[model samples]
Target: MASWAEVEADAPEFAAAVRRLLDAHRHKTLATLRRDGSPRISGTEAQFRDGELWFGGMWLSRKALDLRRDPRFALHSASVDPDDDDPAAWPGDAKLSGRVEEITDPARVSEVNKDAPPGPSHLFRADITEVVLTKVGSPADHLLIQWWREGKGLRVFKRT
Candidate 1:
């Protein structure tokens, strides 16, 4: 298999597509692995800033504890209307493969929250590993999405 950089280089547009989707969508359904090896999914809003994806939750939430033990997570987002026929085609929707890190520093967490308050907000910083954009082909393959990811940031990928 090729390296992460190699994969990202081969599909530059995919990365752009993911960024666009993120900008349009405000909510995401995060799927995490439980200690028992099962999967748990929950809906939450997200904010992307400073090259990281930030998510807030209650400290006692199951998703919070799940990420504490296992940071890996998958996110799914969908357009507000599946039948809409406007530009930005499917509106905002995507699947993201990433890992989460608990934001414990009061200042940093506060920064992540910004207008939103800290405490009761369990923040996680998602380092996007891979991103998939679905729905593009024919009706049979109406969900032909593209995926891309780099080991580092966009600047590094541009150099490589």
Candidate 2:
């Protein structure tokens, strides 16, 4: 697994692009593994802080509980539909997958975010395994997909 900081260190420009897409909207989609090993999608938000990607939830939320049982997760940035006449102008979308480790130390939580809930909550930091971004090529004739994986660095490909 790689920290978001590590991804940045390995691919600064690509990482920046991913971060911009993620922060472009207020809400994101989080996929967690349920007890049956099925996936559960939840509405959540992620932030880049202290060089890592952090996400959390309200106290005892189902998403939180799922993470407690299984740390594996995938997060997708909120996406906007492209105008039919200007698909090439679309900013594209980003998604990542990783396992999160809980943050329980009060001091660490406070250091991560000063606004952490005063009461119970579940906070986690992602140890990302992979990151991907997809977009329509400038001329709108093809699709461009860029991805980075732990130990594999970054790669890009285009498709018609």
Candidate 3:
């Protein structure tokens, strides 16, 4: 596993590229497993906070229900680069495998809500467990985790 130090001590260009992709996209399509073992997908507004993806919404929404049923979820953020818009153009995508937690603290909600673009509802946070750069074709497949220590590139905290 890559250490925090190694991921931090990465090439500036590569790091900036990753940040650009994450910042450019605000909407993520989250997938969860339904009670019957089916897949559910919904679009959500997300923010990168403290190196983790945070999302908020009405507690009664279908997406929220799915998360409540099964915390294991996947998020995908994607878009076309301004200069190109072809299938082969290879726009970047970030996939995160994590569990969702409903944060009920008004103070904490206010803090997270500040950075989130004005939206239609309340907010909750998700603590990312694993992330993959699908656009670059899975960094793990191309480079050893030990080679660059990709683990610490994005630090996430799970709710206790």
Candidate 4:
């Protein structure tokens, strides 16, 4: 796993594209493993701060509990419909998968929550295992998919 900063250092172009998609919206869909091993999807907000991707939720929330038990998670960026008449206008979509370390330090948590509503919360930092972006191709009949994983750098695949 690698920090977002590490990813940027390793693959600047890929990292920049992913960051663009992530910054295009404020909320994302997060998937976590439930106690029974089923998948749970929830709305979440993430921040890129201090060279890492961070997220938090209300204390003891189901999503928070899930992360505490099993840190594995996948976050999908907000999506936008493509302009069928102009595929190039599509901004694209991105997904990130990683493991999280719960933040227990009061000082760090306080800093993370400075802009948030006052209340107890759970916070975590992610170590990314994979990142992906998908966008409509100019030809309109194809899709361009790009992904990066630890050790593998970046790879692209197209679907027609």
- Using all chains and alpha carbons, the TM-scores for the candidates as numbered come to 0.73, 0.96, 0.63, 0.96
Residue 89, model 1: Cα distance from true site in angstroms: 4.0
User: Candidate 2's residue-wise lDDT over 1-160, tens digit each?
Assistant: 9999999999999999999999999899999999999999999978899799999999889999999999999999999998799999999999999999999997887788677658878789999999999999989999999999999999999989
Q: Model 4: per-residue lDDT, tens digit, 20-137?
A: 8888899999999999999999999999988899999888999999999999999999998877679878989999999999999989998876887787899999999999999888
* Segments in model 4 whose C-alpha atoms lie over 4 Å from true places: none
User: Given candidate 4, what's the lDDT at residue 137?
Assistant: 82
Task: Kindly give the stretch of ten consecutive residues in candidate 3 with the minimal lDDT sum.
Answer: 139-148
Candidate 3: tens digits of C-alpha lDDT, residues 1-160? 2221233345444444554666677777778788898998888877756544577666578887777777878777666653333333464565656678777687788777886445445565665555555342232223212112244454332221
The backbone clash count of each candidate, in order, is: 0, 0, 3, 0
- When sorted by TM-score, best at the front, the candidate numbers are 2, 4, 1, 3
Q: Per-residue lDDT of 1-160 in model 1, one digit per residue for the tens?
A: 2222343466656655665676676777889999998999998787766655678778779998899999988888745665545423554367777788788898887767887754466888776676766654443334554556555433221110
Q: How accurate is candidate 1 locally (lDDT)?
A: 0.67
Q: Candidate 1: misplaced stretches above 4 Å?
A: 1-13, 84-88, 138-143, 151-160
Better of 3 and 4 by lDDT: 4
Evaluate candidate 3 by giving its C-alpha RMSD to the native, one decimal: 8.1
